[model samples]
Target: MIDTLWLIGIGTGSPAHVTMEGMQAIREASVILVPHKGAGKDDLASLRHGIIAAAGSTARIVPFDYPIRDPALPYLERVERWHDEIAARWQTALADVGVSGPVALLVWGDPSLYDSTIRIARRLTPQPTLRVVPGITAVQALTAAHGIPLNDVNGPIQITTGRRLRDHGWPIGATRLVVMLDGEASFQHLDEPDLLIWWGAYLGMPEQVLDHGPLADVATRIVAARQAARAQHGWIMDTYLLGRPQDAH
Candidate 1:
C-alpha cells in the first residue's frame, strides 16, 4: 500500500509555475508517477518530466498509460469508472516499482481547481496519506496573460465549463465568467450582441496566445486561431473570460 502520495501542481506546462513546496515534494519523492495521454498529447507527460528535472529531483520516474474515459457511458458514469481505473493504475505502478510512501504525481494547474487528482487518490486501497502543494490555476494565468481584472468592481465572477455555457447559455445575470474545459468554442454558439471575450490558449507557456475584442468582431478569428494551434501542437489547453463591457454591464 502507498503510504504517502503528494499531489504537486506544476501549473500550465511551465516550470516557473511550480511553487517551492512543490519542488520540495518532487525532490523528496521516492517515485514520481507521470501519465502518458497517448501520441498526440505526449507533451502533457513531457511537461511533468520537465518539472521534475527542473527541480533537480532524482526520484524514480514511473510512466503509466492513462486510461481513456469511455464516451459510450453517460458523462458521470464514465468519469466514475475512469477514476477507478486510474486509481488502480497508480496501485500497479507502485507495486511494479516496489515503492510505497513518498510518491509524487505532478498535476497541471492547481489541484483544488477543476482537477480530479484528489478524488481519484481517495479510491486507492488503504488510501494514501495525501499532501497537496497548490500551483497556479488557469484562471489566474489567463487573466495575467491579458493584464485584465477577473471582475468589475464588486461584481461576481462565475467560473463554469464550456459545456455548461453551451447547454445553458450565459449564467443568468452573470456579468463576468471564466470558461474552462471547453472543447468547442462554446461562445461561438451564443448570439449575445454586446458581449466581449478575452481568450488565451497555452497560458503561461512559451507558445501562449491571446485574443480579445467585441465577441461579434473576433469570434471567428479566435476559432480559426484555436483550430490552427491545435493542428500544429496536437493539443491545446485554453480558457476564456466572457462578459459585457463597462457601459453594457
Candidate 2:
C-alpha cells in the first residue's frame, strides 16, 4: 500500500506560480513522478524539474513516458482507458523508484479544475493518503492577465470543456463561462457577435498571449493563432472566459 500521494498544483508553466505550500510538499516528498510526453514537449517535464530545482527539493525524481489515448475510441472510453494506463504507469514508476513513503505528481494548473490527475489518482489499488496543495489556475491567470473579473457580481459562471461548448453551445443562465482543456477552438463555432471572449495561452508563462473581442470579429484570429502556437510548441495549455454584457450591473 502506498503511504502518501501529493497532487501538487504547479500552475500554468510558471515557476513563480508554485505556491509556498506546494514547495513544502515537494521538499517533503520521497519520490516524484514526472511524465514525459516526448521531445518538443520536453518543457512539460522541464517545468516540473524547474519547480523542484527552485524549491531545492532533493526528492528522488522519476520520469515515465505518458500513455497516448486511442483517438478512434469513444471519448468516455478513451479517457477511462487513458487514466487506467496512467495509474498503471504511476505504479510502475513508484516500484522502480523503490519508494515507500510520500510520493508526488506535479499538476499543471489547479488539480481540482479541468485536470484529470485526481481521477487517475483514485484508480490506485489500496490507495495512498491524499494531500492536495493548491496552486494558481489558468482561469485565474487568464482573467488577471486580461484585467477582467471572472464573473459578474452575484452572477453565476459555468466552467466547461471545449467539446461541450462546441456540441451543446452556450449554457443557459451563465453570464460567464470558463473554458479549459479545449482541444478545439470552440469559440469559432459561436455565431453570436454579442458574445465577448477573453482568451489566453500559456498563462503566467513568459510567452503568454492574450486576446479579446467580439466572438465573430476575433474568431478567425484566435483560431489561426491557436493553431500556430500549437504547431510551434507541440502542445499548448490555454483557457478563456466568455461573457455577455449585462444591463449596467
Each candidate's TM vs. the true structure? 0.97, 0.95
lDDT of 1 at 79: 94
User: Which lDDT value does model 1 have at 48?
Assistant: 84
TM-score of 2: 0.95
Residue 156 in model 2: shift from native, Å?
A: 1.1
* Per-residue lDDT of candidate 2, residues 96-187 (tens digit): 46786798999998999888898898999988789889999988899889887787887778899999988898886667889987878888
User: What's model 1's TM-score?
Assistant: 0.97
Cα deviation in Å at residue 192, candidate 2?
2.9
Assess each prediction's global lDDT (C-alpha) against the native. 0.90, 0.86
Candidate 1 C-alpha lDDT tens digits along 35-76:
998889987887788888888998999888999999999989
| lDDT of candidate 1 at residue 197, scale 0 to 100 | 95
Runs in model 1 deviating more than 4 A are: 247-249
Error of 1 at 54 (Å): 1.1
